[model samples]
Target: IDVDKSVDLTNCDREPIHLLGHTQGFGCFIALRFDWIIAYSSANTNDYFGADSDDVIASPLKNWIDPQTLHDIRSAYQASTITGRNERLFSRAIEATGVPVDISIHHNGTFIIIEFEKITDDRVPEDSFVRSMLSQFHRYSDSQELINSTAQYIQFLTGYDRVMVYQFLPDGAGEVIAEAKNENIDSFFGLRYPASDIPKQARALYLKNLLRVIHDVDSEPVPILPEAEDAEDSIDLSFSTLRAVSPIHIEYLKNMGVKASMSVSLIINGKLWGLIACHHYSPLIPSYFVRTELELFAEVFSLELSSRLMREREDESNRVRNVHNQVMASIGSEGSLLGLLEKQFDTMRALIQCDGIGAVIDEDYRTAGTALSADWVHQLTRYLNRQASSEVITVDSLEKVLKNYDTSSDKIAGVLAIPVSKSPRDYLLFFRMAQTQTVNWAGNPEKPVSFGPNGSRLIPRSSFALWQQTHDDRCEHWSDVDVRSGDSLRVTLLEVIIRHFQERSELQS
Candidate 1:
């Protein structure tokens, strides 16, 4: 916890989420080989199974559970192993104790780890709960509404002080789009956090593991017993919901004044698009029943999110398609590329999401909207043709690529261009004006100072002050969908050009 002492900041990413060799104090962790021999235990199995940790380690799974239970478990375990899936066994109460426990089986490549989570009965049917959540999703019209409901629902279920839907931008940085919190806490809605706050590997881990909980940052981590000398001997907990957290992250959370926290992954297309980040101002841990409910809710919400996002993309694609058809129709009738292109200039610029567009064919040039001067456009077009790599070239910063032209950045900061013909140097280009804006960050997001406890090692920054930056060289960002639309338009233009050439040849003959 010493800020002056140095620590290897890189280890935050290399901490091996899979082989953490520990568990958060919410469950009994037991590991067994494929042959059913016990490999390791969390040393706290007595609280759950009435057996000593050492007694369970060197025994078979059949010693504690009945044969029927082991058979059911082994069969489910074997099936999941083949499919690379996880399965939850039954929930049963301890003999004469009335304490309910939920068991789940998942493989970690080396051993099949079984977790026994002590849970309280909520009496809510799984199907009913899922249907209720899904029904709520279908009622929402857009992603923003759904995210708002999800944050509120999670906050209600977990009783957290604040719950926010943290979505990642094109860059690794994140923004809180939807938030639900108690009146006492300050709002973090719309606040942007730097990418380094959650390192790259940590995000990968969140994708692999759906949920992670830190019950109390102040509690000491309970290390795995008989710690092996070699790292290979350690048990992997990549799929573990109760894996102990990293100390660096603990300090990071403490700096934010968050004593406890949990995150539910919001995945889209097998990738992490966002997270339901819940923060607690004080130590508060939900029972396994509540945790399980929130995890299920997140899964259902992710599917709905994927569907909504696809619809939005399809809407954009349809708009581009309409403009493509309109432009093609005009060009087909006129046959004079410059005349037709000038007539449909506004629609073409809209297709590319740009304010200006320019086209050149057989030395006939046309410009519209906020386009640069014709002379400058002609020079830029010639330069672009010489340096062209593909049929469609996009540059977010044109000045960097075209260093010879210092005056070009005033009007044409970014460009998306498509080559219609090579011999005549014919092309269509969409230009975006220079746009500058402020970027807010959670912290400075720089490399940690090296003068710490471990000889000149990297340590986490202690202050989480709000930092802002102003940019000048960058223009409006381009999306993959935008590039695809441009690519499709290029193919259409090529086909039209081919047909136009064929018609001219026939007339000449």
Candidate 2:
């Protein structure tokens, strides 16, 4: 259905970007050899030092930094994992004019990299305020509430027009679960964004870099110069604060009528759970101080969010455990297999929150609730059981995974099939109806990636006409809570069946 299983994402993750020989305009990066000679630098050296890119080449790194500052950096770089040193200065006449520069130093194995970013934000959000903000976050009882509050607080803190908590779903796609927007901005709440928006490699980098900000989307990117001789030797800007973004991403933002953007990663247990995406109608560059505070807030928020999610899972598990008990009780007092199941049909259906529930014993069927005809049920069950493992078989899209099924006639898009006994092919299947969702795509989701005049490289979509399309025959995904119920049901039913069969065998003997 809406599950796109065939599209090639080859370009999404393999975008060899750090070698693009450039950086963003806000900062200038320098790579130095151990002997203090400049090895590589962004071509836009004029922005910071008013020197040609080559001016840094063969020049002692000391010339760019005062002796005291150089000594501090050397001490900090002694350990690879000690964390980098960050200090700011009112750089008087270091370049065309006096401005604030946030200087940073770190080592990347091959080279000692230094970066200078022009800072505009003079004052960061205060510590007391951060604590108060965090205290308010703890007041929230659930993850969704915490995220919703985070969206509002981030938008308020950063002064962006809109902020959204875009949570990734099981299948690469994502949904905006929480959003806070200015009165004039459009609502993106509940809108599902395809995985193509954020490719796999980009996601990996988000874990490494907490904050990615683009002050001016239209500004040209600074290129890295003295092009790296070998692609492998190219700097992996996976950690670069000013790493240039992919051209396609810039175009994608432009089409959405956004001028500036920032994303703060929401990392849960070291993996990215979502992003706090901020968008502005005009260019907005929060100072390094403000961004630093944002990063701290994001890290703390991640820990808080993790705690809330764990609580939710615990609550769900308890509910499932209770359902497990009731289902076992019904099966344990069995008369006829079909009659016992039919009596507890409501409980079984609620266990997974499906459109219908079905049971097939051997080649025959006994079912309750909305389901396909007996013949179709048998066919679907046989097909799913073959592809299934000992664990629960979860199908979000029957058509995509089971190619032999008649897609046109099937109203059930997803199925959770569990085997109670395989000898007679007894199965308890939960079915979900196709949920045709609506999406307001920035461009046609179907034509998300196109080609430029060269007709080789993938380009961003050319349109932003508020394209609305009904997603394919997909259903609300089965959550872990639902699967837990199935797991309990399978174990309980299997035990009862084995015991009953043993008693029958003993009587016959």
Candidate 3:
């Protein structure tokens, strides 16, 4: 654990978070076998239930709960087993403590985990409020507006100091697309954070558990009783609501001056898209009912966001398809491939979103718009022929991939090259001009380590002041839609080439 020697940024990803063998102090945890015998219990369970861990272990769960409550627990366990999702019971009073608690139940491979937190608020959101939010979402055709409204609504509902829509970029890094915060606090909107900030394993856990809350970052973690000697064999708390926070993550929040925080995952197409991250300046824990409401809101928001994105992509695709059809029609009537391309190069450039277009068929090479010199095009084609294997090649920075070319004064930064034929090594190339962007980060992404209370281990940076960075020699990345369009054009051009060969053969015959 020596920060100066063994610990580095990568250690964050290697941390065994799921086997932490602890729970937050505000809640208690109990794990039972399918046969209803207790297998594991939190060390602080007696503080709420007044039963010792030694006595609780190896005992039937029915010994603690009334018959009716036991039946409800069984039913909930059955439902969870059927659906492969967590089941919950809200505002149920335990027989031993007579305290109303919110219970969450889920099963891992070997045990069924039940977590209990004392109920502080029982009010559910009004039906009208939720309906109004849904109505507002439908009214906005733009995704940015929708996301902004979502952040505002969440801040209002949770009474958090700040709420942000943290979106994962094409690269592993994240950007704050929208923000709602108190006037006193500085805005984090449009700020970027490196991928290492939230390591790969942490992102994976977020996918498994949709919502996470840290009531108080400064509170001590309650250990699980009968701690395993081997860390590898410790209890798996992947889905536990009361799972202890990672020490590194706690240090991170402390550095940000955050006392409490919560995040709800935004999932699209079964992949983790981003997070609705909330920050509180002081310790705060929302009631279970309210947290559930927030979960529902996030779910609806994800669906709406996914729909809007898909619709936008479809609109762009339709526009490209129209241009493609026009080009194909002209080629069919003109009965020439390269000739038609040369004549209608302007229209062909509009088929995909790019600054320039080029085509290499056998020996003849042609280009249009802001393209490279003929020699450069020929060299690019040769490079593509050597690197590509019947698939499209996309590069956002030509300098990084293509060598021997003087890129110091190169105007074109990106390329999407599609191979049309293998024999002649013909290609259809799309080019994009270089662009410069200024990015504001919360802190220096390069320097995320510092010595802290826990010896020389790596800790979060102490300051979150704005750190500006300028990026150069890159272009707007070619999106999936662009790749699809390029592939479609390649297929149609291949068809046209085959048809011309067939017609010439018939004439010769």
Candidate 4:
């Protein structure tokens, strides 16, 4: 007797007789043999199977045969014991509803939400419950070293070539505040990108979609429409992942030799903060499971990072305000304005990450505490004497266009010169460099630049020189935008400095 248990099983049965057991399979002639079986949860048939009385259904398939079918079934069955059980469960729900779509997740700060909608492609609204939990975790964070540490942690977690704290600028430009990059790639530690790199439309799309996966830039195209349906036209790129990259953009990445890029947009305070951009040189594909895990971890990291940044900004603001107040008071007390400014260098140096601090004042362009050796200063004197020097102007100029300006043959690696108030008044300036230590300007630093027992300056050579040659358009030999008022730290410092001076002026009057 053959047993067939399909939708129409009754039609396949030839003769039906004897006593029957509901689930234990005890039919008369085939008493000990079980052919036609209906098991709800296996435990319901435990009597004949000799299963322990307390045993529950361990699996839906209880020792069934047919090797190929068993292998296929097991392959499709993802145990709920895994980390993404919730996503898998959601996938099942969608599958049950007969939807042919795939799901993706978008994350920002402490909030995590499904990138799906009941009737549309938009992401779900923020979950208040998730936000509350995130806030508590942030409160427990160790904020002092959080920015740098988190950058490192997230890079490790996501396996990205580089992880950066990208802050958006007012005119649509973006700048890197902090970074963790691979061994071969140089730091863009303080690099800037035009607002055009990420167009307005791309940003809008990013707002709607939290994450984008570019598995392989060189992957074979999955035809958007059947080749039979339309053989003449190319696919629209806006929504299709398979669309070919625009020619200009492809050439741009090729020029830089960036093979793959994965970017996660980070939103903080309901605004676009920047992104955690991951770069891979070789062709790579991250599995769905890996992507899901990475996103969860990345969300946690981004939240911590945003919280730390905001708090630091606030703290810096208060500190600067206090220092400025003191400066104003000192200016009125018993010292020259230049002297008072000199006294403030300690605080300014600490705040601006500068090794040296100086300014060009009035007609003579007087110098204060030299950040470099006196020998280098003499070389700089020539450039400083020019009636119209880029040293005084805010825009790009002669002082900024060259890579190694100091006639000492030692290049002035970085400088921040700003005309704070202009005219006869003092112009605040700041400078910083990894002394005797060549910066990993063009390629990633596998080893830290070695320095002698006594601190000096790093000699820029090889890749550093090569980088200056190639990126001369963007490189500034002495001037850096890090001191720009728009920087979070600079903004806080200026406010504090201004407030202090205002109070001091009143005290003297």
**Candidate maximizing TM-score:** 2
Q: Model 3, 142-180: lDDT tens per residue?
A: 888999988998898789999999999776678999999
RMSD of each: 5.8, 4.7, 5.6, 20.5
What's the TM-score of every candidate structure? 0.74, 0.83, 0.77, 0.47
How well does candidate 2 match the true structure, expressed as C-alpha RMSD? 4.7
Rank the candidate models, highest TM-score first: 2, 3, 1, 4
Q: List candidate 3 segments past 4 Å from native.
A: 1-10, 52-55, 58-63, 121-132, 322-382, 385-392, 404-413, 418-442, 445-477, 488-509
- Clashing residue pairs for model 3: none
lDDT by residue (tens digit), candidate 1, 319-340: 8779778766755533586776
Q: Candidate 3, 46: how far from true, in Å?
A: 3.3
lDDT of 2 by residue, 220-242 (tens): 88778787788666786766777
What TM-score does candidate 2 get on C-alpha atoms?
Answer: 0.83
Candidate 4 lDDT, 221-301, residue by residue in tens: 222111223322322223222223333333334445566666667776666677766666665434333444555555666
Return the lDDT, model 1, position 348: 71
Which stretches of candidate 1 lie above 4 Å from their native place? 1-13, 34-37, 49-52, 60-79, 89-100, 120-128, 168-175, 183-204, 325-382, 397-400, 404-414, 420-477, 488-509
Q: Model 3 compared with the native: what TM-score?
A: 0.77
Q: Pick by lDDT: which candidate is best?
A: 3
The 0-to-1 C-alpha lDDT of every candidate, in the order given, reads 0.73, 0.72, 0.79, 0.42
Considering lDDT, where higher is better, how would the candidates rank from best to worst?
Answer: 3, 1, 2, 4
